[model samples]
Target: MKPHTIKYAFWGAAFGICFPLIATFFELWMSDVSLSIANVIHAHSTQPLLWIIDSAPFILGIVASFAGKKQDKLQELNTHQESIIREKTESLQKRNMILENEIELRKRISVELEAAKIEADSARQAEEKFLANMSHEIRTPLNGIVGFTRLMLDTEIDDQQQEYLQSVMRTSNHLVAIINDILELSKIKAGQIDFEMRPICSNEFFAGVMNTLILAGKDKGLSMNVSLHTSLPEAFIGDTTRLSQVLLNLINNAIKFTSKGSVTLSARMFDADFGTRLRLEVQDTGIGIPADKLESIFNDFQQAESSTTRLYGGTGLGLTISKKIIELLGGKIGVDSTLGEGSVFWVEIPCAACDRPESHAEVIRNQAEPKSLNAKILLAEDNEMNRLLAKSVFEKWTQDVEIDYAFNGKEAIEMLMEKDYDIILMDLQMPEMDGFTATRFIRTEMEAPKRDIPIIALTADVMSVERKKAFAVGMNRYITKPFKPEELISEICLCIERA
Candidate 1:
């Protein structure tokens, strides 16, 4: 019951008691009875009036009990809601703690991954730097050795001396090949090798490769043969140097492994929309490769087996370099082999046929050796042995050839300031000033004739970046160390003539 309902009940009881009293007073008045306070009080003392007053307390008690029960229910509901709220807050705190921990763990992993990446990058850079330094250091000494050996070979000597010098030359050549293989593999991985595409006569190209490698096969008592398809073109435009490198690598590998049977080089051409697709294969009755290992052999520094590296005596980079070179020329290379039989390494490359067939006269001109030169030359070198070797070779190759020497690039600059030489052979690495700076000074700062003088870079650094730097700094030509005297002379003559 509500307070308002209790109030209404009390008012109703008062009204009931008053009504009875009023009714008694009216009856007395009608009966001519005296109307007084005492009389009204006696009139209110009735049964109905007493009953109404008595029920008032009970109604109020009932209303009070109902109100108390509603308040109790509200208190109980508030306590239950508070308990649920506390439980939810605890659960949320626990979830927040877990999420924070996970975020911290992820941050730690990210930091570790970044650190590993940095370490790997540093190691790679260190490796490249080491290879570059080793290449320069090894080639520097090898240049003198090979150069002096060639000079000795040219002189009149007994058969024993000739044999000894030839052996030294061959061994030095092998060393050069190994160094080149290492450098080439690095270049391929770094994506720095540039191909020089030109027209090449198929017949002449094959002949030249065979002429250089036939003696090696003959030494092993293996017959070398070539088979050309009739549909093959006489000439094609491609990277002749890289093509020859691939051919030589395949043929040499075949010859090196084969014991007795023939090593055959076969070629054929298929027509394509762009031009002709040439397929060249080198088949040999060599130690055949395992089926599982054939693909791995084309990877850098990998061979068919560890035993193969020990017996074949190679860096295992030849095939890898060959594959990369072929791919650069837009070709694919593969091998087919059996366990007891032989192996066939094949490559297919697209080539554009030459507009005109290569002439035999052009071949004669290319094969002709450089004639005796009677020109003044400036040789800038830091090493004493290299200086002596170059002077000896120049003297041996020509008569009345005046050659001047400079120990470093600064000295070479001073010499050029004094005298005008026909050609300048500049070395890249030196103590005071490097060759690149000196060449730039000559080209940009010096006077007309001196600045315009033919400058050929002679350095042991054979990286593509070094070569590009040489030309970028105004060097007219570049020659790697351990170079043949004939090639150096030819480069000198060509530079002088062009100038």
Candidate 2:
């Protein structure tokens, strides 16, 4: 209740208690009057009436003194209660004001936090765009580095010059590989990678992976093998390129870590239930990872430890990419290792059955020869240096091979319209038009005869998704930059032969 309302209640209660005593006093006065009248009737009226008037003043005085005392006590209590009510009201008001201020402060803080979040999101988007542009910029030149390197390796040169060029070529390829892996990791982090599943011939897939892994394995003095159940399907609908990368990374990691023992890559049917779940294992007899360090290996840019990182040279992206690719393909991967005994990394995925399984397995063999770029080739590159390097590489490789150069996609289209070429080396990023748009135009606008030429992607951006994109854009082959001369030549030879 309000402060004044409480005072009113106390005052009203004091008045209510006084009413009974007031009535008693009224009755006493009436009795005294009646006796006075009675006595006056019986005796001389004038003699007794004087005594009553004289004592009346004294009786009124006594009653007034008693009422004054009672009223004083009641007023004292009212004053005390009023003081208490004032103090309590003041405290309550202060507390309420404080709470109101706190609420306002919290509201302000919440608004600031929301603003910070919005700014952070905007900054993040800008950063991503910048990184993507840089990726494209770096990739344009690298395409030429590897493409031209391959063309150069096939040329006639002194052994000493060939060896020096080989080293340069190797380093470039290595840098390109690292760049590609980083880009792939970025794509995975951004959740922009798309996976495509189709009928992948297991034997042929293993052969490709094995061919890629052998040189690295041999360099480390390591031996690698592939073992799979014969009952497995000849072809399964899955991301074969990703699966190959997954295998390639694991096997390569094995080769890197190991010094003496052979690394065996074994695959078997772990579980058949739920439609062809297979367990693929890459067991290495190398320096095994500690039990505690096993989990950290899958994290980005993280290795077993600092000491281990120094011992083994890598950006530590292979396993991270491998793990992501496996997960993208609807699977899981893990590691089992001991201190010195060995380590086994494995992945398991669901594979859909192919329509018609091939009856005979192609013989497992190694194709290490670099692709032959001696045939009439058209290189569609935007950067002048890249174009020059590519042209020089072709000129140096085969003296008589016809090489048509285009600085942009538009030039490439004109060249294509004018002359027939055996293969087209196309770059995904360009100024006038990108490879994807140009490829689409070539496929949709050109006649069947014009569109039939093999188009190989010359890029530094090599990821599972990018490869799928190359295929999507009507590219017959996708070759990452800084590639080995042998690998480049082999890819071209394969494309030309297939075409």
Candidate 3:
């Protein structure tokens, strides 16, 4: 039926017909018959074989047509298979391209995120450095101001002059407190706060804190009381400094708010599944917080009332810092108040009971009356006013003490090389050489007695890292700026006694 099949059939029929006619002619020639069409027809008509030969053309045509149909079917099948293969190859290529594009996009996002993280870290480091520098610059001048003011108060002056100096001292102290609060909050937010686990005597700790703050309340014509429960342990394991800080903030707040009535600080202990828990409460009878706003007061820079800031004049970070400190110590803090009567703030922390340490008693006894220090001292300071303040303070203490002054760490080192000094009062920040390097040189490069001399770090930097580094460089003690003259003298006496 197809054209190829018809062509194959026609060629097959022609070959068959030619073969039969040739055979008939060949036979006639062999038999000596006339080689003509008439003879060939007679030969074919007479022979049975000739009749069979005559049907060959038709059978051959039918066979050739079937073979041609099979060939055509095979060609069609091969073309269809090739088409399918081409489409599948293209699909695979497109999918691979899309996958590569997705991978590239993810790689770019990862790079950008890494860059952002690096930038943020750099900025935070820069901020910390700036704060450290600022603290040093501010505290250096404040130390001289406070020191000179205290000395002035001791001299003969009119009542009005005394009043003015006292007010200046108060304002300066308040400013120092604000600076401390800001630095503490920054350390907390940066996760740099560390707590010490040591034995703390309940009575001694509470007594010390009360002694420091009771004067403030009494000056305001208010009574301050401390009540410890009988069941409370004599000593417990906790961070004494951190606990004192929290208690100071709470008691100070209590005294600040209460103008007419008394304030009370109380503590008790209870058993818990984890350990013994200590609960501290500060109660004040003053202008109390509103019922609706009590919970929000602990938030940073937040107060119970909007106008409370103007009336009280505070940064409002006290309670917020206290809350953060308590939480970091694995404790909780809360407050309860009425509108008009009073308010109570409480803190609970887990502490295990421990025996009263003998070392604490020894420390208390040693603090009684420091022996007079009559020795040669090296004072290394870069500030002129600070140097004059130190000289005045020492002159007031005793005439037997001889003090030598060095303008910088380099001068101090040079003085040490030439003379034998009993102690070195070192300042951390100085030109030409810093205290850390000088101390390191003394400890590592100097001879026996000079290397072993007591070195105290009298610095304005209050960051924990600075303190740690000071000790690491062989500093015997670290005292911050604006320190009391009595405290400095006592430390000097102690260091000399130890040496």
In model 2, the clashing pairs are 146-482, 155-397, 370-486, 370-489, 370-490, 371-488, 371-489, 371-490, 372-489
lDDT tens digits, residue span 1-499, model 1: 4444455555555555564555666755765758877765554454455445545555655565565566666767887899899899999999999999999988999999899989877876686778878999999999999999988888899999999999999889999999999988888877778788877777777888888899899999999998888877887788878888999999999998899898999988898777679999999998899999989999888899999878988889899999998888888999999976899999999877775553544311121333446679998899999999888887777766788999888999999999979999999998898899889999999989888999999999988888999999999999999998878877877787788
Candidate 3 residue runs with Cα over 4 Å from true position:
1-106, 227-231, 270-276, 356-359, 364-371
lDDT of each: 0.84, 0.74, 0.88
Residue 401 of candidate 2: its Cα lDDT?
61
Q: Per-residue CA lDDT of candidate 3, range 353-414, in tens?
A: 89997863344212333235687999999999999999998887777778899988889999
Q: State which candidate, 1 or 2, has the greater TM-score.
A: 1
lDDT of 3: 0.88
Question: Per-residue error at 439 for model 3, in Å?
Answer: 1.2
Per-residue lDDT of candidate 2, residues 365-423 (tens digit): 33432233457888998778776876665555446567788877788888899999888
Cα RMSDs, all models: 7.3, 8.8, 5.4
For candidate 1, which ten residues in a row score worst on lDDT?
361-370
- What candidate 1 gets wrong by more than 4 Å, as runs, is 1-121, 196-208, 230-238, 269-278, 327-331, 349-371
Candidate 2's displacement at residue 42, Å, is 26
